[model samples]
Structure formats: C-alpha cells, structure tokens
Target: MFLAATTAGDRVRANPGGQAFCPSCMADLIPKCGEIKVWHWAHRTDDCDPWSEPESQWHIDWKTRFGLQNCEVVMGPHRADVVARDGLVIELQHSHISPEEIAERQRFYRRMIWVVDAGEFREHVDLRLASIRTDPYRQQPTTYRSFRWRWPRPTHARFTSPLFWDFGDGTMLNVRKIHPETPCGGWGYLWTKPQFVRRFAVHVDELGDALEDGATA
Candidate 1:
C-alpha cells in the first residue's frame, strides 16, 4: 500500500520509522523503506485484505501515474489498486492470479478494469496482424491484431472486465473480444501508453497542466 492514514486523517506515503494505519482495514501499518523494493506500508499479520499482494514497482508506477489520491481506494473490504475519478477501478496485476480470484474481484467491483503485466504470460501468447480500419467517429485508424494463447492459464479465459495486457512496451493489447473455445484467442487494438492513460485517468489533465507550466519557479 503506497498511502496510509495518519492519526490526523491525512493520507501520507510510507517513510522510515513512520507510523500509520491502513485506510481500508484501519490496522496498524509498519513502514517498509527497504532498498530492494518500493517503500510501502505493511500489516503485521496477514489479516488484512486476503487479496492483497506484495507491492511491486510495476504496481507503484501505475498507481503513481493515476495519482496517490485516487489509488489504493477502499471498496467494500478490499483496496482497489486505482479508482479513477469517474468511478472506474483499474486493478494493476503483476503476479499470477487464479481464475476464481479473478471472478471474485469482478463480482466485488462491478465497474472495474484490469491492467495486467504481460511480462509473465506474453511469452506463451503470440500476436499477428489481423486488420486495420478507420473509426468513423474519432477519425483515427484502428489496428486490430489476433492473439493465440498457447497453453494459456485458466485465468486468461475468466476476464469479465476489460483486460489491458502490457507487454512492457509503450503499447497495450486491449482485449476487445475473446473467443473462449479451446486454444483461446482474441482480437484487440494496440493502444499506446498515453491513449490508455488518458482514457481512464481524468486527473491526467491536471498533470498535463503542471507539466506545461513554463516556469519551474
């Protein structure tokens, strides 16, 4: 968890020797400022959200891009990775997840999407050019690609929400449609990093403004 609540109800990042509480469970959190991993708050026991995973730089980067205010939001008994201003929950998943867990989260957070780190599974998946068409509304060319999942994990076929697979490149494969029969495959668009971020993050406009300010003074 990147953000914790101080006694004064202010959200703060974990620092060395900092004392805070989990915003979701209100459990005492210990600040972990180690060198190997991204600094974050941890619960003494594994009593908090059962679905919570170890923090990773990939998770941190995506959360930071969405801004801390909108990240680590409490929804029911679980803390969503990133909840956009428009009430969309963007779950950043890097570690392996079970199909049951995926279905559970989908049921819990009805209005949610997934941004998965494809580094782990992209190797088992092959993509090839399918077709390209221009959108009449946006007047932008849309490229479509077909994917073949060789020996795919069961979880790959269990996505109820939108799954954006990040291949560590600047582009993401947004699975627009899926064919769940044996030897699962799908067709989706390759969205650039900015396109994905801009569509989901409304506060990105504020970030853009801050970057556009000519004066660093």
Candidate 2:
C-alpha cells in the first residue's frame, strides 16, 4: 500500500551514499553497522541479527523496550524504511522526508516517521507534518460484562473494536449497543421475575403495533 513515490520497484540499488534494501521486505535501510561491518545490510528480524548503530541521519532512536518485550523497530510492508505499530505510528518529532511523500503515505497507509519541531532535516526539504483527523481503527480483542441497572450505574461501556461507532460530532459513540435486551429500564425487572414476561409480551406487542401503524403513513 505504498504511495507511488515510495514504490519498491523504483529503489536505487546499492548507492554508496548509504542506502541498502532488505531482500525479504524490500525496505530501504541506510547502511549502518558498528562493530560488525560485514552485517551492515542484514535484514531486521524479531531476533537480534546484526547490531546496526543508530545512524545520526535517522534523527531518532526508534528502538524501545516495553514491559517484558522490546519494540521491534523494523520495516513495515514494502513502503517505509522504518515502522512500528500500536495501531499507530511511533515517530520522532523530527525526521526528514518530503511533504508530498508524506501525504502519499497517508493516502493508503500508516507509517512511523521522524519529526522535528522547527529545523529542516534535509536541504530544501519542504516537509511539515499535516494535521489530519483520522478515527483510529481499534484491532484488539474486546472484553464485555453484564450490567445491572437496579443499583450501580454503568462504569464503562463494553465494546469490541468494530462495535464502536464514530458519531460525526466531536464525540464518537457506538452506533449500536449489541445486547439481547432492547435498551429499556424494564430489562432488569423482567429478567428478575418470570411473571414480568407476560407484561413484557403485551408491551412489546403494543409497541410493534404502534410501529406498524406509523409505517403505513
């Protein structure tokens, strides 16, 4: 999903100026290696392969350790040189890339970029971070709990990633709350007492009839 400018097939091959390609992922990595210069162009894997000293040109040290795991600062799909996903891009406040290239990346992708507050990264690099409002697509498993309206109010709404909705307003609420109980106050009472089912049936029947009447006109 790379923008046309960052397309893989158009890469510069073995430029002495310091750019190399990862054979497996085709990400353009700058030639950076410290003690073991021979492994300068090794592909980045989850396992420690080669220790490439953080290049000054990278603008930021993207490698990070969280909890018991280390953040794998490797390349993403065939487009960007560096990548990290929290379902979001992790980037420094200052990295050098063209503005056009950045916009194109946003068109069909998500990327971690180096960002700088004020100074330019490369000469004549008219790169500025553009502010685009994007609703984050949550991609993790969701947990749910049953609520009882008889006493305590809802502490939090339980929703899976896809279940939530963005209500065009500044506030985004779930379009629908998927519970067997049609949102109503009688839910708790009826579930508590079997006799209430009789009354509930009549109520639902009347409500259905009202809806049917409304549909006619």
Candidate 3:
C-alpha cells in the first residue's frame, strides 16, 4: 500500500524509521526503503491481503501521479489503488489479471476506470492507434485481435467506462463503448476475435479536452 495510517491517524508515505499500519488490517507495517525497489510499507506479519499484488516501479510511478492523498483509498473491505476527488476509482493494473477478477473489481467499484499495461500487446495497440490518428475519417473503426490470454476484454456492455491501455512508453489508448459480440468459432476460437468487439479509441494526448468536459459532467 502507498499510504499507511500513522499512530496519530494521519496518512503517510513510507520513509526511513517511520512506523505505519495498514488502514485495512491495522497490522504493523515496516517501511522498506531499499535502493532496489520503490519505498513502500510491508506487513510485519503474514496478515496482508493475498489479493494485493507486489508493486512494480510502473505501478508506483502511476500512483505517484495522483499524489499520496488520493492513493490507497479504503472502501468497504478493499483498498482501491487510487480514488479521484470525484469518487472515481482508478485501478492501475500492471500484471496479468483474470477475467473473473476484472469483473469482480468492476462490480465492487461501480464508478471506476481501469488503467492497464498493454505490455506485449503494446506494439499491436500502437499500430492500431497510429492508423486511427493518421486517418480517423477513413479508418472509421479498426479492430485488433488479442492473442495474449492476459489482455483484458469487454466482458459486459453495462460496465462501460473509459479503459486506458498504457503502452508503458507514454502512449495510451482510451477505449469506450465496448461491445463484446459472439465469439468466432473454429480455429479462430483459439484467440479473441476482434470482430466480436466494437469500441471507440482515442489517444491519451487528445483526451485533455474530453476530460475537461467530463469533469463538468
């Protein structure tokens, strides 16, 4: 967790010699400031939530973007990675996650957005995004198949929210209005069918105006 509660009930980041406790479990948290990894608090015992994944530099960097104040929000029985001031939960997913897990998180945090690392799929995403940017009018809509099992897909239409797929190189694809159609049978079933999905894409750099408009809504 990025933010831990001090004895005085104040939220603090991990620092040398600082003592903290998990906001959810209330267990003693040890501040790990090793040079190899990002500084963060760890449970002194084996009481930490199993669902919490090990934090990577990418995850830490993204969390820092929102600042510590908006990081590690305790909601019900789970702690969200980051919660915006407007009550939007921003979940940054770096590693592979199960579809079931994705559905659960969306169900738990109804008002949320997912920032997923495209990782290996980054190249495909970038190419498609470039095509959209180069000739949006001509391209209209482009579809790309997801061969990687870890890649997230639109499970349901009702869970419609902007999903920012980060390429980890400062490029991001904002996808919305996702509709997952019937799967293509035969050998094509081996991979996720691009034709079965319909989504609108926009570059993150071009999202400033849209985001500003959304803030008002």
Best by TM-score: 1
RMSD in Å for all candidates: 4.3, 23.1, 9.1
Stronger candidate by lDDT (1 vs 2) = 1
User: Per-residue lDDT tens digits of candidate 3, residues 1-217?
Assistant: 6678988879998899988889988888999889988888888776465557667777776665555666777887788887764677888787667777877888888988777776666543313222213223124343332322223244423334556666555445454434345341111011111111112112333334323322121
Best by lDDT: 1
Model 1 earns a TM-score of 0.87
What TM-score against the true fold does each predicted structure earn?
0.87, 0.26, 0.65
| Candidate 1 C-alpha error for residue 26, in Å | 1.7
Global lDDT of each model? 0.80, 0.27, 0.58
Pairs with backbone N, CA or C atoms under 3 Å apart (clashes), candidate 1: none
Tens-digit per-residue lDDT, 149-205, candidate 2: 222112112211222121111111221233324231111000111111111222333
Off by over 4 Å in 2: 1-23, 26-54, 57-60, 65-85, 92-95, 111-114, 117-217
List ranges where model 3 is wrong by over 4 Å.
Answer: 129-161, 177-217
